[model samples]
Target: MSRVPFYLLVGVLLVAGIAVTIYRHVAFEVPWVPGEQRQVWEVEAQVNFIAEGESAKVNLALPSNQEGFRILTENTGSSGFGLSFLDDDKGRRAQWATREAKGSQQLYYSVQLLVAPNAAQPRVEPPPPDQDVSWARPYDTAAKEVIDQAYRRSSDAFTFSRELARAFSGDRQDENARLLLTQFDRPTLLVKLLNQAGVSARKIHGLLLEDGRRRQSLTTWIQVFDADNDWVIINPTSGEQGRPDNLLLWEAGDQAALEVQGGRDSKVTFSMLQHNEPASVAVRNQLANDTLLNFSIHSLPLEEQSLFKTILLIPIGALVVVLLRVLIGIKTSGTFMPVLIALAFIQTTLFTGLAGFLLVVAVGLVIRNYLSYLNLLLVARVSAVIITVIAIISIFSVVAYRMGLNAGLTITFFPMIILSWTIERMSILWEEEGPKEVLIQGGGSLLTAVLAYLAMNNPWIRHITFNFLGVQLILMAFILLLGNYTGYRLLELRRFKPITED
Candidate 1:
């Protein structure tokens, strides 16, 4: 059979295998909400001491019986506190008392309550605006000082307002609100200043649904309770001064600390212990019971998993490179140079990394050519080239450091051995085949590297390799087929045209 048809059939079979693998391992899930669900009850207690030698009262706010749950019992204790339990149908409420303290005291207690089928009835409190208290007031007083300093140093009222708006509401560009929130370095500082301004604010930390990465720093904002408008959000860091963002409002004042604390004591302990189980556990049993299957896959022998993952792709990439070289008549220094370069490209990414490799290789070649004039032996010449390459990298690192580009550090991962070998091969090719042949081979090597990078990085190829072990069979079939390809390459088409005419 003609080599063309043989290789073509092999490619087709390999593709088919990949398709089958994807189809078999696909996961499907039904979308359904559970009928029975656990609901969270928020219970908050605040103990404020007037800094005097007197009894401190704890204010407990319970969602009224209209909301559910009845007040079971109330009690007082000598732990320097009194407790009052109020229960309506919806949930239970606890009010505890404390003695005069130097600083404001916060007490958190929680109770597990049964969920009622009916909707919760609302509880009335000191209106929405009154509930907007600064949650971070006790954390640091310097946070307030920072804002005051920023406001004072601001150029004008307009500038101050803009800074404040950006700092508080994140709308520094707004002319009106910018003056209100100024120079605060952090959201926490802005919140403290807003609290001093009689605007309720707190530091809120939570994932912004827009993105999943947890913020390195706290996303601090102020929540103000306006009698008419309810709770509004203010981002002090958004603008110039702590200007408000159109009086942004939140449903629960953005005080997640208060909400989490409302559930239980200041410290809650949860422990899970299982004992008297078999000490000798099978790997398969552990794998089967593993909650996170993706991570459990790594527990398999590293060599087995690594080989299983990359073995299929290696053959596919090699086949593609070989086909390009043999059939397409592309030139390269060695059979595997392009493959190794492609593997290197995996680390460096497409454009920048490839460019870096090429640049390094070219420089190394120039140095190798210079060293050739000294009549160095083959081994000594290669060692010199390697040393020169390392020296070049060290110089590049120093320059990059001086330039303050941290990415320069990635150059350490570049394959110096590959570059040295390529330089020597290209030099030899240059001498024997001349520049034209050298160029052809060089171009081919680069082209193969590019192709290999694309094939290796293909999402479908990666997905199949990772999900199924059957992909190796497909790769094997391709390898077998490619091994037999004996047709004239595309580059040889013109050279062989005269023979076909006969």
Candidate 2:
């Protein structure tokens, strides 16, 4: 191919890629590939109760400002009932009250949240004093002893609270800890001890975010205010200090999460599910509450989108193969054969795919060498090799399956005809150019495949290729430009060492 035509082609494709990328980003407002999808969660707090003929008042706790998340909007699924936010015993409560009510009622208060990067923590108020905490009989002495030990052994508020929590569970605990554990739950007792130590702390309730969960109860944990005004929360049972990454801080204070009046068998439950939303939708919603995801791939059927996700990365594999062969002087079996092999490796994984490919090719080569004695024609010999390669793969898969290796079954998708042809060529190369050249070419091919696999498997590379279709055209332009190189490759430079020395 003339270098001029190749250069012109590359220039054309490069322009096309850039132009399309600009159009998508400017006119359609598709986000840059990295910020394409936001981790958005839909969390619901549900209240169920039986209402008598008397007036009914149902109060439920609601989530406020939390870290690393921007609250989008909340839902109040209430019909024919009064809804209001009141400062009850709980810090903030969503009260649904009605007069002359009867029968069953289920209410949901849901919030949509988008996770943001490097989000700042919300400001927390100073904890209240431990009011009327005069313990009964021996419990009073136990509380004092626990607090004194924790404060003396620790240097700071966070450490002091952790020490006080640890004293209740482990064998190193004293009689004070045993007495406290028997008197109150671990979370409640931990806060009481921290308060006695003059550290401002409280017992807060939240739910560990588990997807598709229902009828979940609130879990209690210890939250202490340090000197610098940051909230230091800890798991009371394990003494592991820190808020859990996925916990939803629902409410604080001594009040229950849900309270019911003039009713029997009242209960509250929580349900939460998470979803990955494209930034296009977030942008649209931020613009004017547009429901459309705005011309993103998420608009496609999920099955088709998944297929496209894999198919789009093939160009990345091809680009890797081209760079290795053209610039680095790697001798692959066929021009793009290693690309296909590497693509398959993305599915079966590197170790399994390499082991399977070698096993199939090796057995086929041995079988073909034996058949060479029959003086077969070229067409018949190729056909025979293809069939033999398939049969060997089948038997190997069966044995691997019987042995409980599920990864082996994925090898069924390996291009059997290509491997057959590779073995045939390597066999011919072995006789004509010797085993040294055969080994060199085969090793080079395997190395290229491995490099290509690594490139294609990168999460950032996969994201860019699948989300931004223009990147594939840019990749094609890159491969085209690399194809026109006329100088010696990196490996070929070593072959001319004496000339360089002169």
Candidate 3:
């Protein structure tokens, strides 16, 4: 074989692995380290209303154009009612309907949001003209006076809105603000005052998120459009200029946060809980919604994902076997047998696995030695060995259970067919090469299996192999490189040591 083509293939594998790993880490935001956790908030909204005997309908506003957070999952809990989501120029809303309702009804909308700094931002639009800003009687005069006072000290829309907010925030409130305050709350009043001065603004409702909070209501804030056609959030109470990190915008625009038809006394209350989740979990959840990436492992059902998590570690064990057998000249009964044994070890811990393996194989060898006297055909003899192996496992498992050795029950995790084959190979080795050679190969197999178990069971290795698909390519490259190596094994180098000593 041309070494050039071989080297080129290895180079391609290495490069491709590294490039893909980097891409997944950067593009998909998959973490490099295991057990890294990100803070996530689970926010649930409870919509309660009293419906009469007639048909009833409810519309609840939902969060959209989130900042500093991404919604990973959203679901509703509305039993016995028809539910549908509506999106329009107004905003996103969830509507529920039921005919002939006669009692208090409750509906739920819950969302899991991942905290991320680079979360998507809403498009910037100039604020719509205020069509409903007119105030009646003395309140109309008071609003005009308040807007004129703030406009005189400010240059643009943002500063004008800030000045108006500042005017009513502190102890030395403007007389006009005090008069307006009697008729309107601070946020609603600010929106009216800003619009009266020809500065585009509106009142937005948001939730102040805190860990483990329940039954919290919305906090109203002023949203003003700046000269650049971007929405600038202002704290109407504190006169703050930007949105706070803890604030979640739940409702915007000039629409009611909730509306109920054929129902009365309707209200929505929010409950939120915050916790940490592994970065891999967050990536899985975030990507689960993307249709194009549905073919990836993260998109699999949870049961299949968990199965693949274990399955992906097999390559690591195979790499360990290749290194032990090819580079260290370790002898084993079968080439990939150590890998299967290592997988069992993962399920049954190191010391317990070692004990169970020895007990099974030692007893199996004795049984095979006796069966050989029957002179059975090869296929029938191997079939007998498999049945014998299963019988041994069952007997041992029951005995262990009776004795309360729960760990021993895990011995069943060992592959039965593989164990039978191993016994068959070892028996043939014993007959052909004698007991001494059999011991060497059997001991080598156990040692290789132990080493492979250590590699496959490592937390970092398991995490990387599961999260990064590129690692499989890297492992394949390494196994191929080891396969091509014809150099002296580490044990063989001992022969050269004697020559150098002389």
Instruction: State each model's CA lDDT, in order.
Output: 0.52, 0.80, 0.87
Q: What is the lDDT of candidate 2?
A: 0.80
Better of 2 and 3 by lDDT: 3
Tens-digit lDDT track of model 1 for 164-251: 5453343323332233234334565555455554444444332121112222222445444434333434454554323232111112
Badly placed stretches (over 4 Å) of model 3 are 1-38, 48-53, 72-80, 101-107, 122-164, 167-201, 212-214, 225-230, 275-296, 370-381, 398-406, 481-486
What TM-score fits each model?
A: 0.43, 0.52, 0.81
2 versus 3: better TM-score goes to:
3
Superposing every Cα of model 1 onto the true structure, what RMSD results?
Answer: 21.8
Error of 3 at 364 (Å): 3.2
Superposition error at 157 for model 2 (Å): 53
Instruction: Write one digit per residue (lDDT tens) for candidate 2, span 368-435.
Output: 88878899999999999999988998998899999999999888878888898999999989889998
Question: In order, how many clashes per candidate?
Answer: 63, 0, 0
RMSD of 3: 4.2
Clashing pairs in 2: none
> In model 2, what is the error at residue 75, expressed in angstroms?
10
